[model samples]
Target: MAEIQVNEDEVQVGAETASVCPACQALLSDGTIQGKSVLYCTKCRGLLLPIANFLPLVEFLRTLRRPTGSDIQPRDNSDADRHFTCPQCGKSMTGHPYGGPGNVNIDTCESCSVIWLDRNELQRIVMAPDHYPVYSRYDSGGGLRRTN
Candidate 1:
């Protein structure tokens, strides 16, 4: 009797991916039981893989997060959602519940192309220093500065 063999490459490996992307909310399945971590964005084709044990790759992975859109435009919230006025743009911010590391809840301003990250939302994006620049005032020569 001959045993049937299966090719790993012939299989579609994405459907069983465990986690979903924090930014786009897409599946990130291709997993290996966490001997290490792989952070990838299927929609954006961004992949983050750790090299060895406890390397700095995770830090780099966390920093890989970038703004997918300038702002998430307003929508009907009759489905029970929280609202916030963007500190950067003063627009009613519509938030999305994020389930990544810190579980950041984020919102955006459509009028001014600014994002409103609630509480520790920035931490989930990147573990580097959290320094967000807000531009509301114009200086003498049209330069930008952080205001109080």
Candidate 2:
């Protein structure tokens, strides 16, 4: 992809892509978040990421995040009712609360294997405290425990 520097953190890729922003109806522009290529809406600041890259991208962002001592914001139940179509496959995207700590509402297009995140949703996920089970060497049973 041909890339032009939009700033230190974002790059604008060649406009050969047909990805359209589901929320804003604008042409989705190519950009990199934490060095990962993603299509983003300049108007709505929404993001489209492949499902396979979702976890890895979250992990990558987590490494760079600093604890903010803030609680994870409540999930927006309203967004769970919103509908959107996939920019890639033109299929209806399934909207649901993300099964993660951030309480984010996400849209997934199974046929396209892609996810749609609205503005600041990615940041909310990365900033949410760790809630996954953690195994400690101190525990002989290898059971899960909360560190935070």
Candidate 3:
């Protein structure tokens, strides 16, 4: 496990003493999205999310999606050419298209079980057309409500 320290402008990884952004090599800052903790790069707007937290977040997002009449699209290998090293383990991370309805490519570090999402990737997933189970779900009369 990596110990994370979050100050006003930077995040430090305890064992290594530094946690730089995978996308921009800039220092990362601690941040939260939908109340889930993450390390964010101010320069690149990329995010580093723990797999433990991300899985539940994805499950919650899935609950918001309307049932798809069709199956998900097949994944593409266009992102395979790009590679990233894990900030925690210093091993090469695997890049693959996210398995959800969205087409964003995400990087995962198997050793550390962390994920790296580039700028706007999360927004793309959240705004995907298939994700709108019903716009009314956001209204007071609906059963669902935004948490963060």
Candidate 4:
């Protein structure tokens, strides 16, 4: 687990990322990102699940700034094709679970519906070792709001 000092003020932990796809690393074809959105790949036009949510590009980009330019050591979570409803919007989601173990994992809203993180996901992320660029402002004290 890494630690990302977001914007100097708030330090959002465990938000590290590797270089995205080969061509346009940041945003995939129809706008996908780190284990988030299922966007149509530009070159292939196939439905590829991005790193996370295709919701907020700005936030994703902000959190992706790494000093080292080497590619990320890709993990073997390739079989994560199950669909779960977005806790905030009730829309079906496709992608990997964002955040680390201790911290709460957030089911990000599709197209920025609303970000909902489970209890441990946030803590695990903040407590990670490497740390990504995007930082979450110290907002939630008690975590996770189940709307359904």
Name the best candidate (by TM-score): 2
Instruction: Write down the lDDT of every candidate, Cα atoms only.
Output: 0.39, 0.75, 0.65, 0.35
Candidate 3's C-alpha runs over 4 A off are 1-17, 58-79, 131-148
Please provide, for model 2 over 1-148, each residue's C-alpha lDDT reduced to its tens digit, 9 standing for 90 to 100: 9754664223344353577898989998877766777888877877898898889888877787777634545566877777898999898999988888777889999998899988678878887778644434343434233445
TM-score of each: 0.27, 0.76, 0.61, 0.27
Off by over 4 Å in 4: 1-82, 97-106, 131-148
Clashing pairs in 3: 66-133
Angstrom error at residue 112, model 2: 0.8
Residue 138 lDDT, candidate 1, scale 0-100: 59
lDDT of 1: 0.39
Q: Predictions ranked by lDDT, top down?
A: 2, 3, 1, 4
Q: Which ten residues in a row have the lowest lDDT in candidate 4?
A: 7-16
**Residues 1-148, model 4: lDDT tens digits:** 8843332212222322331322233322333334344433233222223233322432544365443332222233442453445432446654555644223233444563544332223323433435333433433543232222
Model 1: CA > 4 A from native: 1-80, 98-102, 127-148
